[model samples]
Target: MAKAVQKIKLSPSRDIPLNKLVLSQKNVRRIKAGISIEDLAEDIAHREKLLQSLYVLPILDPEGQETGMFEVPAGGRRYRALELLVKQKRLAKTAPVPCIIGDMGTEITAEEDSLAENVHRVALHPLDQFRAFQTLREQGRSEEDIAAIFFVSVNVVKQRLRLAAVSPKLLDVYAEDGMSLEQLMTFSVTGDHARQEQVWENVNKSGYDEPYQIRRVLTESTVNASDKRVRLVGLAAYEAAGGNVLHDLFEEDGGGWLQDVALLERLVAEKLRTEAEEIAAEGWKWIEVGASFPYGHDHGLRRLEGVLVDLTSEEQASLDALQAEYDALQAKFEDADELPDDVDVRFGELEEALAVFENRPDIFKPAEVSGAGVFVSIDSEGRLSVDRGYVRPEDEAPAAAFDVERGTDTSSTEGQEAGASVQRAAISVGGASTEPEEDDEDPARPLPDRLIIELTAHRTLALRNALGENPAIAFQAVLHNLVLTAFYRFTSSGSCLEIGLRTPTFPAQAPGLRESVSAKAVEARHESWKARLPKSENDLWDALTALDGGAQASLFAHCASFAVNAVYEPANRYNQGRVSAHGVRTRLDQANVLARAAGLDMVQAGWRPTVDNYLGRVTKPRILEAVREAKGESSAQLIDHLKKADMAKEAERLLDGSGWLPEPLRLADSSPSSAEPEGEAGPLPEFLAGEEDSANGSDEHPQQLDAAE
Candidate 1:
């Protein structure tokens, strides 16, 4: 029923000499875009042959006869490239350029011919180009050679090769439009066809087949090169030791990932032990070595006070000169809103040079070193951390012994007894005397116990009322007590207020907590304040009063930070004696209020879900729950079939940077634990329950309310 397609005479194809061809003005291309003529020229030279025919018209003389010359219409760029090669002497001027000669008798104009040739051309698919490059590679062309031949960068060639090297099944999926080019590019991150296919099957089953998720699944088992252990060992040493690094060809991989985590950890431990052995030469009692020390490992052990080694004359002179130069530069740039690059860099150099002198290591006496040990470990930055001069209980010097009086009278029994009594009184303290003494305080007439208690009781109540009325004084009083407890050995405060907030240290190090951004910030703040404070506790009261209101508030906050105990410990009947179930819950609930006020973000605080810190410690179900909460149910199901350890490890990779915190570490606004089971830990403690009502004003003026600080 359909008419047959028209059969028309086609243009004659012929080989025209480059010298006979001239660019036609009828060509539609004007503005420069896509590939440059220089690159096209290089490609033509590299190929040694033209791949496509140019559209051309026969040049005519005044008599309307062929002049044996051709004018290119659509392929002007190609003509210019060939002309360039002739000029460069890479190709002969008379080289034959294949072209289609436009028929003069045809209805098509030269302009129409040019437009049709360009408009009707179909661009090669990216996959086809990749496969082509792959073919070239397989045919003994090196990546560099392919790059040179194609007029592209070597990395570009490598990326294309990687994409081509993806699993054949995946490539087919891509070719069939079942998957996207982006997805195929991610597959280029790995070369294991089986693993890639397995991941693809999982991705299909889970329906979370995003490119990033695919990359996560593929690289979950690998260790980040930025990992402290890898950084400590270094890439060169790791590679030299026969460990593999998986690098992504198409992305900024941050130095890629170290595949052998166990090997990395082993290297870290061995290096740490070697460092410890070298440190042993310094005469420490013992050197405890580890990749990282447990939090509170130094607890109960007395840290030795080592004196900073004083600078020599030459060192002092150098430090002074550096300081002078730095100060002069600062004064010169006092009004500068932004320093010049060179000036800024110089400032950093000056600061580091000065810090070297100021941060000199402490020198411990040989006698003290004999009783103290060193803790050799890697810090969170992957640098060797040496915490020296810690004395264990057993290694500590024994208490001074009590002995007989050397100059006892020895004249008579009465004198001997008196000498013994004198020696006991001099060496010992407190408790009732064994023998009665002559009454000295009875005549002075001390107040009766009941009378003293009664008199102080009224004063205590009045003091409480007065303290509540003046928040500033109450705040200062609390700070003073905290300061005494924090810095003094034996603290006794006349103030009746008892915050009794014990600063609890972590029992487990929990991976990177020691050097977390928040922890480091808090420690830096504390150290700055400590440096500004008077060393003696006796001067603390005067110093506290001397500070400005802002400084006073800051000091109060620093003291209050010690009271924050957000550490998660299971609450149950067995947790009695020390941590009651109710008490633990109430403490955490209060911590939530504080957390909300502080606008605390665990993610910004450098808390990440890692295998060592969280995932490895939880059950498989819990791991899936975390992943599901962070990356959706589809992602969670992707690794659900793996063993607990493997699942946890993979879940850790998925959860990293997801900013997902466990329930204990999570913060809720307004009311936390509202959905928690009732009677699980009984009602909130009376003090905690009344806290809100107290803030609004209750009986006994329930402590001064901190104004949302």
Candidate 2:
């Protein structure tokens, strides 16, 4: 019933002489790729034999007579390797090479056979290769040796090993293509399998898994060794305290992360205390030692003047020589495309030499040091920043008088020595109670609460300045208050002075906000006023009366600008009365009116969207919204496929110069209008619009304000 199976002829395997073999035209491999021929030849020389046999067909003349030479259809690389070995005298020309001779009577052509041989074989999976490298490493093969065998860089071998060292659970996930290689690499930053699995679970649960997020989750409790705080507490000190550090081998880690934050903080505090003790040795009345002090910590305190100590003659000579050298190097490199290495190194040396001369110590008088105190803290650069010579209000009097004013207590040795020594006070264990301290001056009541004290302090000084500068505006403000009091039934106004207010310090702000353009402008204005004002407060009125009308008006405007505060405090949501929710809303609307009158343009005020400022810190959705608002949906779509970090970066580039602003920074009057041409595209999504409205001021038309910024 069934046909008999036919026997088929097969290719025969044989050993062919190296010199008798030649590369075939139908070999198909043309462009150079993968491993180099030289490395392959070296590999063969080391092994002393080929691992795979070449597929070859015997060449013949038109007469069908054997030419005794073979043409390689497949395994051309192996043939080339042998040929290279023979040429290099590493092998004999007559050395036998392994070959599989294909029958000439076959239907398949040489080119098809070569293509099939090259393409049909399955390439090794990356994970399998990684495991193979790991096995070799375990067998005592060095990274360099492995790299040499594979014709790869040592770094590549190290990277594969690092990947192989990851948890088997994650490796299986990677094998199944559930996670990307980059994400796998991120997981490799930490060695704990539990942590790796935990982070993976968190990634799935959060559904915001990016490589950066994985890294952040893995190192959340850890502190970066390069962080200023960590730098303040040296890594050596942290390590000496038994703190552990995790290293990232696959990427630049900036010296890795310290895992013990509490230990680091303790070391930092101890070091700071030591530094504080040294500062106290200078006879300061008090030393407020802290990791960081609030901006304007010196507010309301008198700053004593100090002179810079003069540089010694030797130092002066060194500075002069370094300056000369630096100038010569700069001139020499000015015409060149880039500075030479030696010249750049010389410049660095010169800078270091010059810094010693530039940072001469400031010399304060002994009397000032006795009466004043110092703020011993760390600067942004991780260096100690000593703010000296601030005299607190209570300590303004002479030090002797200040101490004498507080009567001697019964506990003093002078008063109690004659009597049986009082029992020594018990040491307070743990820490002091967190209960609020009662006011010393008024024991029955807290001294106008801290916030009120701060607020009134700033308001009082600012009102004084405003009244001095703008007598006309001050009189009008008084009249307006009187009119409101006489005409209205109730008034809950906190203060009678309706003049502008200037806060002495911002309790909350972004990093480096003190260096912002607005902050600098205010500082410059304050300095200018301080210079012109009479030294004595008694003479302030006379000085103000002498000012011209234009000058008074200009000063009045500057003072009034400071009173604007549209900050939406949490009280508006809960505690409510000091600033009611509706009142806060109304306040913002009025503030917007003031801003429009003043022609405030935040962009021109030096606010731009940078990674540090806006882009890199927000969510991907928020970044997309920003790009959509600034560039349009199509542009937003172009980067939708990227991860959060990459999307944020790309969005920053696309939105640059598009004049986009976050809702809080956007002017109240800049809201889109209905009067534009019909069918105009690019309307913000409803969800984003709701978010913007809640964050931004009320609906005010652009035409209601000044021209667009």
Candidate 3:
């Protein structure tokens, strides 16, 4: 302020006739890029005026005198647009165009002025543009209006508005370039600024701060719409109960997350209870209700066999018509590349119609229903699974011995009650009621346990000696034991030899595991053998003896197949004292041996990496890794910018037929994999080599992530 500053003269702006303006050759832009001049002309014609002023300089004569015409050095595009308008007669030839005439006396050259004008300009920040959209929205402009004005889709407008509506603090951080756009995009899932900032603070320095991880943390408390509970209670029902759902506009969220988990749980329980009551009305002694039951829930319970009920004539006709219509549609569009919307809808309707007949319940006898109970639960696909006719061990009737004299067994309900009087009159010597009637004092006393054991021990030694001599009988005995463990685990061993086989049923399995190709083949093979075999277990020896060597071997193989326990369970790996890690590893090693023997190939087994099964459940980096491995780095790059869900889906499509298998599903190499500890993750890919150190850095704490987990 001590010294006065001198002011410099600035360039003057004035209106120049369209005809008076000439294109400058000194303009730096030559190649056609971005918007075309034709489009710009149309835009100018639509607006009826130019929004930006052109930079012009007077043309010099040979003697350096001013010419009436001016040349645009920086705004040549505008001059061409105006020229186009004038030629089209949309604007008069003599129309005045706004221009900022550069000082002719200045030392700067036209080219230098043009370059400065172009280089000194700054484009608006994306955050500013987003807020501008927000402002337009706040000012009562419909999203459609904003989209129309900005030449963008309404969805784009909505995405911008959503991004702008994120916490002001986060937006400020975004403005400061504190986070990437993707991280900011995921943080927009929630409106709670405090939670957003806390999450950012928790994961900012940690490599764990991926977009999907942030989204996972934000929605941790909320239940996924694809959850079994949500499927049991429809989305509309959950929303109608005053629940809020946070949806993502960015990716496929499978309908989004339900904010009210407690509400959803309560609704699921209520619906299950209602379903149970309905089933109980069908004469069940008791009913168990839940979203799902553990596999083998009826391990010790007896499953009563019931015949498939015949459909009514009306129902059968409807089913036939539906099938015929479906077939007709399929034949009609057999050569079509894609189906029409109506055809697609009708196909779904026809499928539903067909499913109704297929799912028709079998009717159990009244007596069986009175003694058995129902397990009303939801299947993996969220369909109601009413497992009727399971009789608990305690509910079973007391066993009655055969009355040799009457040639009847009194175990049946009617037999027990009706034959009571007749049997008592004759002083029955069998069954529970025949226990030592004081009148006769003639009853078969129970044999001493030790005496029986000694007698059976002798018989067992003799039988073992005989079985050792005869390979055929030994094979049949082994098959019998396997058959019991496979199909009738509830049946106690009756053979003297204790051949052990344990088939651990998986508590959780992939959806439709029972409907897989391999599963169906196994089922068909088992049923074919069962149809040829005798009904009673007591006749098993005769049935085995009746079979030829080939048939006996096939039966043995079929039964032995059920004993394969190749399933990997985390609970089994860390069984405290029951099962050590080495034990689990050794079990899997044996499974590998079996796999090699069977020439098992997972790809041929129809196990592919699908979104629902594998890809969609893993992290984005993992999906990229799979894509990189199967397709190549270039292919991975194509989907690198996509959100986690979209990336997983795209990766699945890319990995199709690539024969890629996750480590767990892959056959172990010839190397001793059993020697490696289960805790080792092995070597990561080159692209993700440093990710581990960053993800689990010693200085960084991922408390929020662990807490959410």
- Stretches of candidate 2 exceeding 4 Å from the true structure: 4-10, 216-226, 230-258, 334-337, 398-517, 524-709
lDDT (10s digit) by residue, model 3, range 289-377: 65554323565688787777898899889888999999999999999999999999999989988988887888887667666777766
Task: Tell me each candidate's TM-score.
Answer: 0.64, 0.69, 0.62
Global lDDT scores for all candidate models: 0.65, 0.65, 0.65
The digit string of per-residue lDDT tens for model 2 on 97-133 reads 8899997877889999999997898899999999999
lDDT of the structure predicted as candidate 1: 0.65
Model 2 error, position 419 (Å) = 32
Runs of candidate 3 exceeding 4 Å displacement: 1-6, 31-51, 59-67, 79-95, 104-107, 329-348, 398-546, 553-709
**Candidate 3 structure, TM-score to reference:** 0.62
CA RMSD, predictions in order: 17.7, 11.0, 15.6
Off by over 4 Å in 1: 1-10, 60-64, 86-96, 293-297, 312-354, 397-529, 532-709
Question: How far out, in Å, is residue 432 in model 3?
Answer: 46
